[model samples]
Target: MPTKSLTHPVRTRASRGDIAVLYTVHLDTSHPTTGCDVSPAAVHEEYVVTRVTSVAADGAVTSVQDTRWSYDNSSRSLQDIPGVAKIFVIPQDRVDVEAALATAGAHTYPDTTVLRPYATMDEVCDAINPHRH
Candidate 1:
Protein backbone atom coordinates (compact mmCIF):
# COMPACT_ATOMS: atom_id res chain seq x y z
CA MET A 1 0.00 0.00 0.00
CA PRO A 2 1.17 3.51 -0.77
CA THR A 3 1.20 5.61 2.39
CA LYS A 4 0.67 9.33 1.94
CA SER A 5 -0.03 12.45 4.02
CA LEU A 6 -2.31 15.13 2.64
CA THR A 7 -2.16 18.57 4.28
CA HIS A 8 -5.06 20.99 4.15
CA PRO A 9 -5.62 24.59 5.29
CA VAL A 10 -7.66 25.13 8.42
CA ARG A 11 -9.57 27.83 10.35
CA THR A 12 -10.13 27.09 13.99
CA ARG A 13 -12.94 28.70 15.96
CA ALA A 14 -11.90 28.28 19.55
CA SER A 15 -14.15 28.18 22.57
CA ARG A 16 -12.39 31.34 23.75
CA GLY A 17 -13.62 33.05 20.57
CA ASP A 18 -10.29 32.78 18.87
CA ILE A 19 -9.47 31.97 15.29
CA ALA A 20 -6.18 30.52 14.07
CA VAL A 21 -4.62 29.60 10.75
CA LEU A 22 -3.48 26.02 10.57
CA TYR A 23 -2.46 23.32 8.11
CA THR A 24 -3.59 19.74 8.50
CA VAL A 25 -3.39 16.43 6.71
CA HIS A 26 -4.79 12.94 6.94
CA LEU A 27 -2.63 9.79 6.67
CA ASP A 28 -3.99 7.11 4.45
CA THR A 29 -2.96 3.65 3.27
CA SER A 30 -4.36 3.46 -0.24
CA HIS A 31 -4.27 -0.34 -0.39
CA PRO A 32 -4.82 -1.95 2.98
CA THR A 33 -3.61 -5.49 3.61
CA THR A 34 -5.74 -8.04 5.39
CA GLY A 35 -5.31 -11.66 6.60
CA CYS A 36 -5.01 -13.83 9.71
CA ASP A 37 -1.90 -15.32 11.36
CA VAL A 38 0.59 -12.48 11.66
CA SER A 39 0.35 -8.83 12.42
CA PRO A 40 -0.70 -7.30 9.11
CA ALA A 41 -0.62 -3.80 7.73
CA ALA A 42 1.43 -2.39 10.57
CA VAL A 43 3.22 0.86 9.88
CA HIS A 44 6.93 0.02 9.91
CA GLU A 45 8.08 3.61 9.36
CA GLU A 46 6.96 6.95 7.93
CA TYR A 47 7.83 10.55 7.03
CA VAL A 48 5.43 12.98 8.65
CA VAL A 49 4.84 16.61 9.70
CA THR A 50 4.53 17.88 13.24
CA ARG A 51 3.54 21.56 13.36
CA VAL A 52 0.54 22.86 11.37
CA THR A 53 -1.99 25.70 11.17
CA SER A 54 -5.77 25.88 11.59
CA VAL A 55 -7.03 26.64 8.10
CA ALA A 56 -9.47 23.81 7.49
CA ALA A 57 -11.47 25.25 4.65
CA ASP A 58 -13.72 23.90 1.93
CA GLY A 59 -10.90 24.35 -0.51
CA ALA A 60 -8.93 21.68 -2.27
CA VAL A 61 -6.30 20.00 -0.06
CA THR A 62 -3.19 18.72 -1.87
CA SER A 63 0.43 18.17 -0.81
CA VAL A 64 2.37 18.33 2.44
CA GLN A 65 3.69 21.55 4.03
CA ASP A 66 4.33 23.19 7.43
CA THR A 67 5.98 20.28 9.16
CA ARG A 68 7.35 19.72 12.66
CA TRP A 69 8.29 16.12 13.45
CA SER A 70 7.36 12.63 12.45
CA TYR A 71 6.81 9.47 14.46
CA ASP A 72 9.29 6.70 13.66
CA ASN A 73 7.88 3.40 12.41
CA SER A 74 4.51 5.05 12.18
CA SER A 75 2.10 4.89 9.26
CA ARG A 76 -0.03 7.67 10.71
CA SER A 77 0.44 11.20 9.39
CA LEU A 78 0.33 14.34 11.49
CA GLN A 79 -2.56 16.54 10.43
CA ASP A 80 -3.18 20.22 11.12
CA ILE A 81 -6.89 20.77 11.18
CA PRO A 82 -8.83 24.02 11.50
CA GLY A 83 -9.98 25.29 14.92
CA VAL A 84 -7.23 23.30 16.69
CA ALA A 85 -3.43 23.36 16.81
CA LYS A 86 -2.88 19.93 18.24
CA ILE A 87 -1.21 16.97 16.54
CA PHE A 88 -3.27 13.87 15.94
CA VAL A 89 -2.64 10.48 14.32
CA ILE A 90 -5.51 8.97 12.38
CA PRO A 91 -6.29 5.74 10.58
CA GLN A 92 -7.54 5.82 6.99
CA ASP A 93 -9.04 2.36 6.97
CA ARG A 94 -12.83 2.23 6.72
CA VAL A 95 -13.36 -0.41 9.42
CA ASP A 96 -11.07 1.36 11.86
CA VAL A 97 -12.54 4.77 11.06
CA GLU A 98 -16.09 3.53 11.58
CA ALA A 99 -15.22 1.85 14.87
CA ALA A 100 -13.51 4.89 16.32
CA LEU A 101 -16.30 7.21 15.19
CA ALA A 102 -18.79 5.29 17.33
CA THR A 103 -17.63 7.35 20.30
CA ALA A 104 -19.03 10.60 18.88
CA GLY A 105 -22.52 9.40 19.87
CA ALA A 106 -24.62 11.05 17.15
CA HIS A 107 -24.41 13.62 14.40
CA THR A 108 -26.61 16.69 14.30
CA TYR A 109 -25.38 18.38 11.16
CA PRO A 110 -26.31 15.54 8.83
CA ASP A 111 -29.56 15.17 10.83
CA THR A 112 -30.27 11.43 10.60
CA THR A 113 -26.64 10.76 9.80
CA VAL A 114 -24.15 9.95 12.56
CA LEU A 115 -20.56 11.11 12.65
CA ARG A 116 -17.64 9.14 14.08
CA PRO A 117 -14.14 10.04 15.21
CA TYR A 118 -10.77 8.90 13.91
CA ALA A 119 -9.28 5.50 14.61
CA THR A 120 -5.98 4.66 16.24
CA MET A 121 -3.07 3.42 14.16
CA ASP A 122 -2.89 0.13 16.02
CA GLU A 123 -6.51 -0.65 15.33
CA VAL A 124 -6.13 0.24 11.70
CA CYS A 125 -2.97 -1.76 11.32
CA ASP A 126 -4.51 -4.81 12.91
CA ALA A 127 -7.55 -4.63 10.71
CA ILE A 128 -5.58 -4.18 7.53
CA ASN A 129 -2.88 -6.68 8.40
CA PRO A 130 -4.97 -9.33 10.04
CA HIS A 131 -2.69 -12.27 10.91
CA ARG A 132 -0.90 -14.56 8.53
CA HIS A 133 1.49 -16.41 10.68
Candidate 2:
Protein backbone atom coordinates (compact mmCIF):
# COMPACT_ATOMS: atom_id res chain seq x y z
CA MET A 1 0.00 0.00 0.00
CA PRO A 2 1.18 3.52 -0.80
CA THR A 3 1.86 5.70 2.21
CA LYS A 4 0.77 8.85 0.38
CA SER A 5 -2.50 9.44 -1.46
CA LEU A 6 -3.45 11.85 -4.20
CA THR A 7 -4.81 14.95 -2.51
CA HIS A 8 -4.26 18.43 -3.90
CA PRO A 9 -3.35 19.62 -7.39
CA VAL A 10 -1.34 22.58 -8.63
CA ARG A 11 -2.97 25.34 -10.61
CA THR A 12 -1.10 27.53 -13.06
CA ARG A 13 -3.02 30.66 -12.13
CA ALA A 14 -4.62 32.06 -9.00
CA SER A 15 -8.24 33.09 -8.61
CA ARG A 16 -9.57 36.18 -10.37
CA GLY A 17 -9.53 38.32 -7.23
CA ASP A 18 -7.43 37.32 -4.27
CA ILE A 19 -5.18 39.19 -1.88
CA ALA A 20 -2.01 37.61 -0.58
CA VAL A 21 0.77 38.66 1.74
CA LEU A 22 4.11 37.18 0.76
CA TYR A 23 6.78 36.70 3.43
CA THR A 24 10.50 35.98 3.34
CA VAL A 25 13.45 36.03 5.76
CA HIS A 26 17.10 36.92 5.24
CA LEU A 27 19.64 34.72 7.03
CA ASP A 28 23.12 35.97 7.89
CA THR A 29 25.31 34.50 10.63
CA SER A 30 28.75 35.95 9.92
CA HIS A 31 28.70 38.32 12.89
CA PRO A 32 31.80 38.17 15.07
CA THR A 33 31.63 38.47 18.88
CA THR A 34 34.98 37.63 20.46
CA GLY A 35 36.07 40.96 21.82
CA CYS A 36 36.10 42.04 25.48
CA ASP A 37 37.35 45.58 25.12
CA VAL A 38 34.08 47.35 24.68
CA SER A 39 31.79 47.86 27.68
CA PRO A 40 28.82 45.91 26.17
CA ALA A 41 30.76 44.00 23.53
CA ALA A 42 29.63 45.18 20.09
CA VAL A 43 28.90 41.78 18.68
CA HIS A 44 27.48 41.07 15.25
CA GLU A 45 23.91 39.79 14.97
CA GLU A 46 21.54 38.41 12.29
CA TYR A 47 18.39 40.17 11.08
CA VAL A 48 15.04 38.73 10.00
CA VAL A 49 12.93 41.07 7.90
CA THR A 50 9.11 40.98 8.21
CA ARG A 51 7.46 43.11 5.57
CA VAL A 52 3.77 43.54 4.81
CA THR A 53 2.10 43.70 1.43
CA SER A 54 1.31 46.97 -0.30
CA VAL A 55 -2.34 47.67 0.47
CA ALA A 56 -4.22 47.54 -2.82
CA ALA A 57 -6.59 50.39 -2.13
CA ASP A 58 -7.98 50.31 -5.65
CA GLY A 59 -8.59 46.59 -5.51
CA ALA A 60 -6.32 45.94 -8.46
CA VAL A 61 -6.06 42.42 -9.74
CA THR A 62 -2.58 41.09 -9.06
CA SER A 63 -1.23 38.51 -11.42
CA VAL A 64 2.15 37.07 -12.37
CA GLN A 65 1.90 38.43 -15.91
CA ASP A 66 1.91 42.10 -14.80
CA THR A 67 3.43 41.82 -11.30
CA ARG A 68 6.72 42.95 -12.84
CA TRP A 69 5.61 46.46 -11.87
CA SER A 70 4.29 45.69 -8.41
CA TYR A 71 5.91 45.10 -5.02
CA ASP A 72 4.73 41.47 -5.06
CA ASN A 73 6.31 40.54 -8.37
CA SER A 74 8.49 37.76 -7.08
CA SER A 75 7.39 34.34 -8.34
CA ARG A 76 8.88 32.71 -5.27
CA SER A 77 6.30 30.65 -3.48
CA LEU A 78 5.81 31.74 0.14
CA GLN A 79 3.51 28.78 0.62
CA ASP A 80 3.03 25.16 -0.49
CA ILE A 81 6.52 23.84 0.15
CA PRO A 82 8.50 21.71 2.55
CA GLY A 83 9.20 23.25 5.98
CA VAL A 84 7.00 26.19 5.04
CA ALA A 85 4.24 24.98 7.32
CA LYS A 86 6.42 25.75 10.29
CA ILE A 87 6.66 29.42 9.34
CA PHE A 88 3.93 31.88 10.26
CA VAL A 89 3.35 35.58 9.61
CA ILE A 90 2.71 37.66 12.66
CA PRO A 91 -0.16 40.14 12.92
CA GLN A 92 -0.09 43.41 11.00
CA ASP A 93 1.46 45.57 13.65
CA ARG A 94 4.61 47.59 13.00
CA VAL A 95 5.07 48.48 16.65
CA ASP A 96 4.92 44.85 17.68
CA VAL A 97 7.34 43.95 14.92
CA GLU A 98 9.78 46.66 15.93
CA ALA A 99 9.61 45.59 19.54
CA ALA A 100 10.16 41.98 18.57
CA LEU A 101 13.08 42.95 16.38
CA ALA A 102 14.47 45.13 19.13
CA THR A 103 14.45 42.13 21.44
CA ALA A 104 15.97 39.94 18.73
CA GLY A 105 18.14 42.67 17.18
CA ALA A 106 16.39 42.21 13.85
CA HIS A 107 14.48 44.33 11.37
CA THR A 108 12.14 44.24 8.40
CA TYR A 109 12.63 45.76 4.93
CA PRO A 110 9.35 45.16 3.13
CA ASP A 111 9.34 47.26 0.00
CA THR A 112 12.97 48.31 -0.23
CA THR A 113 14.51 45.10 1.03
CA VAL A 114 13.58 41.72 -0.41
CA LEU A 115 11.22 42.92 -3.16
CA ARG A 116 11.16 45.85 -5.59
CA PRO A 117 8.29 48.21 -6.43
CA TYR A 118 7.13 48.73 -9.98
CA ALA A 119 4.35 50.66 -11.76
CA THR A 120 1.85 52.09 -9.30
CA MET A 121 -1.87 52.50 -9.96
CA ASP A 122 -1.49 56.21 -10.48
CA GLU A 123 1.15 55.68 -13.10
CA VAL A 124 -0.91 53.04 -14.86
CA CYS A 125 -3.98 55.24 -14.91
CA ASP A 126 -2.03 58.30 -16.03
CA ALA A 127 -0.60 56.37 -18.94
CA ILE A 128 -3.99 55.11 -20.06
CA ASN A 129 -6.16 58.08 -19.10
CA PRO A 130 -4.22 60.60 -21.18
CA HIS A 131 -4.38 58.46 -24.30
CA ARG A 132 -8.19 58.12 -24.21
CA HIS A 133 -8.45 61.84 -24.97
Candidate 3:
Protein backbone atom coordinates (compact mmCIF):
# COMPACT_ATOMS: atom_id res chain seq x y z
CA MET A 1 0.00 0.00 0.00
CA PRO A 2 1.10 3.54 -0.77
CA THR A 3 1.71 5.74 2.23
CA LYS A 4 0.52 9.31 2.19
CA SER A 5 2.76 12.22 3.07
CA LEU A 6 1.74 15.82 3.58
CA THR A 7 2.33 16.51 -0.10
CA HIS A 8 1.38 13.28 -1.92
CA PRO A 9 1.45 9.50 -1.78
CA VAL A 10 4.85 7.84 -1.85
CA ARG A 11 5.16 4.21 -2.80
CA THR A 12 8.28 2.12 -2.34
CA ARG A 13 7.69 -0.62 -4.87
CA ALA A 14 9.86 -3.19 -6.59
CA SER A 15 10.30 -2.91 -10.35
CA ARG A 16 10.75 -5.41 -13.18
CA GLY A 17 13.98 -7.45 -13.00
CA ASP A 18 14.32 -6.58 -9.34
CA ILE A 19 15.17 -9.60 -7.18
CA ALA A 20 13.81 -9.94 -3.65
CA VAL A 21 14.88 -12.09 -0.70
CA LEU A 22 12.37 -13.92 1.38
CA TYR A 23 12.78 -15.47 4.84
CA THR A 24 10.09 -17.88 3.83
CA VAL A 25 8.11 -20.32 5.94
CA HIS A 26 7.11 -23.27 3.84
CA LEU A 27 6.81 -27.07 4.06
CA ASP A 28 10.08 -28.77 4.88
CA THR A 29 10.01 -31.11 1.94
CA SER A 30 13.79 -31.04 1.58
CA HIS A 31 14.58 -30.50 5.27
CA PRO A 32 17.75 -28.62 4.38
CA THR A 33 18.17 -27.15 7.85
CA THR A 34 18.85 -28.93 11.10
CA GLY A 35 15.83 -27.30 12.73
CA CYS A 36 13.43 -28.60 10.09
CA ASP A 37 11.28 -31.68 10.66
CA VAL A 38 11.51 -34.70 8.37
CA SER A 39 7.82 -35.47 8.31
CA PRO A 40 5.49 -34.52 5.47
CA ALA A 41 3.72 -32.02 7.73
CA ALA A 42 6.95 -30.33 8.66
CA VAL A 43 7.46 -26.56 8.61
CA HIS A 44 10.48 -25.06 6.92
CA GLU A 45 11.94 -21.58 6.97
CA GLU A 46 14.77 -20.18 4.89
CA TYR A 47 15.96 -17.31 2.74
CA VAL A 48 14.91 -17.43 -0.93
CA VAL A 49 14.31 -14.99 -3.78
CA THR A 50 11.96 -14.20 -6.65
CA ARG A 51 12.37 -11.85 -9.58
CA VAL A 52 9.84 -9.07 -10.05
CA THR A 53 8.26 -9.33 -13.48
CA SER A 54 5.82 -6.43 -13.17
CA VAL A 55 4.19 -3.76 -11.03
CA ALA A 56 0.66 -2.46 -10.82
CA ALA A 57 -0.48 1.02 -11.89
CA ASP A 58 -0.89 1.90 -8.20
CA GLY A 59 2.75 0.86 -7.69
CA ALA A 60 1.79 -2.27 -5.85
CA VAL A 61 4.09 -5.30 -6.24
CA THR A 62 1.46 -7.93 -5.72
CA SER A 63 3.02 -10.70 -7.79
CA VAL A 64 6.31 -11.86 -9.20
CA GLN A 65 7.80 -14.51 -11.51
CA ASP A 66 10.86 -16.69 -11.27
CA THR A 67 12.35 -18.89 -13.94
CA ARG A 68 14.09 -22.21 -13.63
CA TRP A 69 16.17 -23.60 -16.45
CA SER A 70 16.47 -27.23 -17.42
CA TYR A 71 18.45 -29.01 -20.08
CA ASP A 72 16.30 -30.08 -23.01
CA ASN A 73 17.46 -33.26 -24.76
CA SER A 74 14.45 -34.57 -26.71
CA SER A 75 13.37 -31.82 -29.12
CA ARG A 76 16.59 -29.85 -28.70
CA SER A 77 20.13 -31.18 -28.93
CA LEU A 78 21.71 -28.85 -26.36
CA GLN A 79 19.49 -26.05 -25.18
CA ASP A 80 18.25 -24.57 -21.91
CA ILE A 81 14.52 -24.75 -21.27
CA PRO A 82 13.06 -22.07 -19.05
CA GLY A 83 10.21 -22.79 -16.68
CA VAL A 84 8.42 -19.76 -15.30
CA ALA A 85 6.36 -19.56 -12.18
CA LYS A 86 4.16 -16.67 -11.10
CA ILE A 87 3.96 -16.14 -7.35
CA PHE A 88 1.35 -14.14 -5.46
CA VAL A 89 2.47 -12.08 -2.51
CA ILE A 90 0.11 -10.99 0.21
CA PRO A 91 -0.49 -7.36 1.25
CA GLN A 92 1.35 -7.33 4.60
CA ASP A 93 3.86 -10.18 4.56
CA ARG A 94 6.61 -7.85 5.73
CA VAL A 95 9.67 -9.80 6.87
CA ASP A 96 11.88 -6.81 7.53
CA VAL A 97 13.36 -7.56 4.07
CA GLU A 98 15.94 -4.96 4.99
CA ALA A 99 18.00 -5.55 1.83
CA ALA A 100 21.06 -3.49 2.54
CA LEU A 101 24.28 -5.32 1.52
CA ALA A 102 22.73 -6.96 4.30
CA THR A 103 22.39 -8.80 7.49
CA ALA A 104 20.22 -10.80 5.08
CA GLY A 105 22.35 -13.00 2.77
CA ALA A 106 24.88 -10.82 0.94
CA HIS A 107 27.93 -12.93 1.66
CA THR A 108 26.11 -16.15 0.91
CA TYR A 109 24.72 -15.00 -2.43
CA PRO A 110 26.53 -11.97 -3.80
CA ASP A 111 24.63 -12.30 -7.07
CA THR A 112 21.38 -12.04 -5.17
CA THR A 113 22.57 -8.95 -3.32
CA VAL A 114 21.57 -6.75 -6.23
CA LEU A 115 18.04 -7.99 -5.71
CA ARG A 116 16.96 -5.28 -3.32
CA PRO A 117 14.35 -2.74 -4.28
CA TYR A 118 16.05 0.48 -5.32
CA ALA A 119 14.01 2.95 -3.34
CA THR A 120 16.14 6.01 -4.09
CA MET A 121 18.11 7.34 -7.03
CA ASP A 122 21.34 7.25 -5.04
CA GLU A 123 20.65 3.72 -3.91
CA VAL A 124 19.96 2.64 -7.46
CA CYS A 125 23.23 4.15 -8.65
CA ASP A 126 25.15 2.71 -5.75
CA ALA A 127 23.74 -0.77 -6.23
CA ILE A 128 24.46 -0.61 -9.94
CA ASN A 129 28.02 0.60 -9.28
CA PRO A 130 29.14 -0.27 -5.78
CA HIS A 131 32.71 0.97 -6.30
CA ARG A 132 31.58 4.58 -6.93
CA HIS A 133 32.69 6.50 -3.88
Q: What's the TM-score of each model vs. the native?
A: 0.19, 0.20, 0.31
Better of 2 and 3 by lDDT: 3
Best by TM-score: 3
Off by over 4 Å in 1: 1-83, 106-133
lDDT per residue for candidate 2 within 32-83, as digits (tens), equals 4444433233432221222333223443212221132334534333332212
- Clash totals for all candidate models: 30, 1, 0
lDDT of 1 by residue, 5-117 (tens): 22322222221111111222332356465564233344333212222222235421222222122224222222323322243333232123333222222312354543222
- Report model 2's TM-score to 2 decimal places: 0.20
Tens digits of per-residue lDDT, candidate 3, 16-94, equal 4444433334554555545533564465434334434456786545444322211231121111212212222322222
Stretches of model 3 off by over 4 angstroms after superposition: 1-11, 29-41, 69-133
Ranking by lDDT: 3, 1, 2
Instruction: Score residue 31 of candidate 3 by CA lDDT.
Output: 50
